[model samples]
Target: MNRHLDTFADSIIAGKRLSEGEAAELSATSGTDAFALFLAASRIKEHFLGTGIDLCSIINAKSGRCPENCAFCAQSAHHATDSPVYPLVDEERIVACAKEAEAAGSHCYGIVTSGTTIRKGEELDRICRAVRRIRETTSIAPSCSLGIIDQETAVTLREAGVETYHHNLETARSFFPSICTTHDYEDDVETVRVAKRAGLTVCCGGIFGLGETAAQRIELAMTLRDLDVDSIPLNFLNPIEGTRLARADLITPLECLKTIALFRLILPEKKIAVCGGRERNLRDLQSWIFFAGASGTMIGNYLTTTGRPAEDDWQMLKDLELTAGSCRE
Candidate 1:
């Protein structure tokens, strides 16, 4: 099995795309096999993305009152939660956070909002102004997660100097109905398409541990591979109190590592970042993400949950002898 893993890594380095059966086989690795899997993933990561890690930070520009009920989300209005509720933050506040993120050594800074979609007149204009300012004042690339956006909105953001548009499919198309009923899976897929069509790089991915099966996890990865997204942000589930999955079991740290490795093997050349749930889910194994094939991670607080201090992440990178690479690199 270890030799096979090495061969798989070699094939990936030679530009072979893993088939569903091959990815499923890799997903079932355990014990010693899992260690070999991580090593293989690490080799693949180095070959494609180099040893340097990319760091990204996000500001929740707007919060709560989202109509869509993603089972893992804390900000959805469909479930009562302690998450903050606020309007789109002012342009100055948004740009300020971007500056802070850049100073913290983040390569990409995202301005995220909670809603079905961003309003066009005032809200969109404000975010566009903020993106323009971020481009002018900071070296960090600005991205936006303003919910389901159209081609017009995507182009408008790109024109304002937004480098990437983020929209997660949330889960596998087959399992999406179990997590979010108000919105169809195709809507999220379309958002990725719209962003790509409008000349924006799409950062698309899904959250795991939503009662999805291993097969379903592979399904989501294959879907993203087909979409040909520029980057994939892999989030683990951090069950929030008022959400539907509050009682959901936390996937083991090894499982989280395996998932990261699986994504790296499947999406070999793409920028795969372990975002959100890293601290809570990975626990003691938090530093193993890169070893398990992740090329980057989100360094600051998540949408509603607080991440560990950025200094801690910086120190971890130092301990690993890794440097944070620019997203544009």
Candidate 2:
């Protein structure tokens, strides 16, 4: 183990944060040094956040016909991907999905819609109703990822019992145009701000490996820290066939672990729930996420792809002796 890496880790454990240059150097670690880097992150997580793991599930409540042109998304009508396209499901269906998630030991159930935003209409009403019933019928927390929300919508969702709001910044401000252009970076920032003003916990994080540089990942983490988000869902990009990023190279499993560790070191006590692209991106090394300092992960189907069976995840957790984390507690 590199003594310098150990020293840096100690500093973080002592509440010392990395400067931008220090963050850049850590992001560049690999081989044996990388091992030490990840070890430090795991230790920090165990020390500061405890060994608790937060597991959540998301249903693609609404699919496709997205107006934005994010290069990494198959749901955009701008792309010709063979993804399912549909309006928001009925309240009954949404409630059923939430119950299924709760039954599977998920602490939170998220309703993610594929659009620039869900305008105030029948879709929004159904989503609000679904959020209410999930709370009334089950012991699970309800969250929503209905893009670019205004203060009024955030208040409405909060009134309907939505505890958390999900909106990703997707990439660093400097690199934003490369991944998406239809929406402004500030548009996302504003929504997170609005949701927070309405007393909603913001669950925000961006996708990795969309051709962003290592420094850019650090930049994204710093932004999330500044936002004081309640939870951060780190998603590795899954290059969908029809999306512009299909030609983008796959992020290696080692790099994925490194990024998770990086997020943990940067955010410290904040909830780090590793979400989409774990199966494809991490492959055989999926269990390393906990060691990399992730406090939780998403289970069941992703927005555009199938996830490993929930039983598989449960068995993995049992083998690792990691417990499922709950927002309620």
Candidate 3:
């Protein structure tokens, strides 16, 4: 099995794409075979991405009252969770957070909001101003998650010094209707295309463990490959209380690692970041993410939940003898 895994990894390194059947086979690995899979993924990662890893931090520029009904989201107005509800923060605050994230060794600083789409007038202008200020004031690259943006908005953000535009498909196309009903999966896909058309890099991905089958996870990865996104942020379900999936079973640590490895094999050359539920889902095995083929992670507080201290993440990287690398570069 290890030899088979190594051969597959070599093929991927030689520019072969993993088919859906191969990905599903990799997803079914377990026990010692799973460890072999992780090692193979690590080899692929080192080959394409090197040993250096990227660290990113995001500020919830706007919070709560999201009209979309993503089942795993606490910020959705459709769910009665206690996620923070507020308008977009002032430009000063947004720029200040970017500086803070830079000080914390983050390569990218994201300005994330909580609505279906940011308003065109005051909201868009403020975020653009903040992004310009961030570019002028900090070394870290600026990214935005304004949601379901059109080509004009994507162009505007690119002109404002925004390096990347983020919009998640949230789940597999086959399972998207079960996770979100307020919007179509195609909207998110088109947003990625629009951002890319406007000459902006796109960081797009989805959360797992939303009662999705392993095949569905592979399906999502294949879709991402077709989209040709620059970065993929893989999140595990944290199950916020009061949301539809609050009582959903937590994915096991090994399963989480397997998911990471599967994605690495499927998207061998893309920037894969383990974000959101790393602490809760991976727990003591958080350090193993790099070995499982993840090349980056979100270090600061998530959109609603607080992450572990940045010092801890830095120490983890140190312990692993990995250096922080830039995501945009």
Candidate 4:
């Protein structure tokens, strides 16, 4: 174990990316040394990103009524989860959420909607207007996760001051079909490509605990590494009641921490956030992620899932003495 840690330390110090086998081995590490792996990841994170946490908050601008069939998602029309079905919020309401996020010390505000596509129309226009309003009114960087978009729509978003576009590819190509059927994995790749072409920073990631294997998770990270994603939001599946995957119990806190550490080792310089299921799965040990090379965390409610309140997240940061990202203060 010590010899492997030495090799891992050497690889990170030399700025060399890990092989898939090495990553798989890192995922399989056990016991007290798991904490040692976390320490190594933290060292790499410090060398690159410092102690600043990329604190972000999201508002589900549009919820439910999604047309896709992602088995783990509550918003999917194929499921019967009792989530609020609402149209896109008005520009004023959206702007209000941005204000709230800013007041809470979030460096970025993400406007997320559940949909297959957000093409040019009143829906797109409203979201663009909201982004413009947020940019004009607050210092918070406005971001969107409205699903697949064309080049023209991407350009419109960039022009409206949308700084980042999030579109998670979910999992590796080999494991994607097992999670969702309404959309092909390549379509997601193209969306990120279009967003990049339109001059927007891309934030892409996936959910664990969908019963995917460790090798599959490593493959997903390799794909994100290839994309050069600016931010990776790792979500643990919450298995909300009534969703098709509700009965699935494929993840634990230790496994989730290992994944985060592995992500830090892989995407060392990118902002890696421990998002979603932190409140549920991480249980009492959530704060330890800062030591495990996690440079960011998502606060506030998630789409169709409840999150710890902003005050509790703030207190957590206070307890850890962590600061917001470089841009925040």
lDDT, residue 51, model 4: 89
lDDT (Cα atoms) of all candidates against the true structure? 0.93, 0.91, 0.93, 0.88
lDDT per residue, candidate 1, 1-329, as tens digits? 99999999999999999999999888889989999999999999999989889999999999999999888888999989999999888999999999999999998999999998999999999999988888888899999999999889999999999999999998898998999899888889999999999999989998989999999999999999999999999999999999999999998999999999999999999999999898889999999999999999999899999999999999999999999887894
Give the per-residue lDDT digits (tens) of candidate 4, residues 191-295.
Answer: 999999999999999999998899999999999999888889999999878788989985778888999999989888888898989878889989988888899
| Model 3, span 273-327: residue lDDT tens | 9999999999999999999999999998999999999999999999999999888
Clashes of each: 0, 1, 0, 0
lDDT of 3: 0.93
Give the range of the ten consecutive residues with the poorest summed lDDT in model 2: 320-329
Clashes of 4: 0
RMSD to true structure for each model, in Å: 0.7, 1.0, 0.6, 1.4
Q: Could you tell which candidate, 2 or 3, scores higher by TM-score?
A: 3
- How do the predictions measure up, each by TM-score? 0.99, 0.98, 0.99, 0.97
When summed lDDT is taken over every stretch of 10 residues in candidate 3, the lowest stretch is 22-31
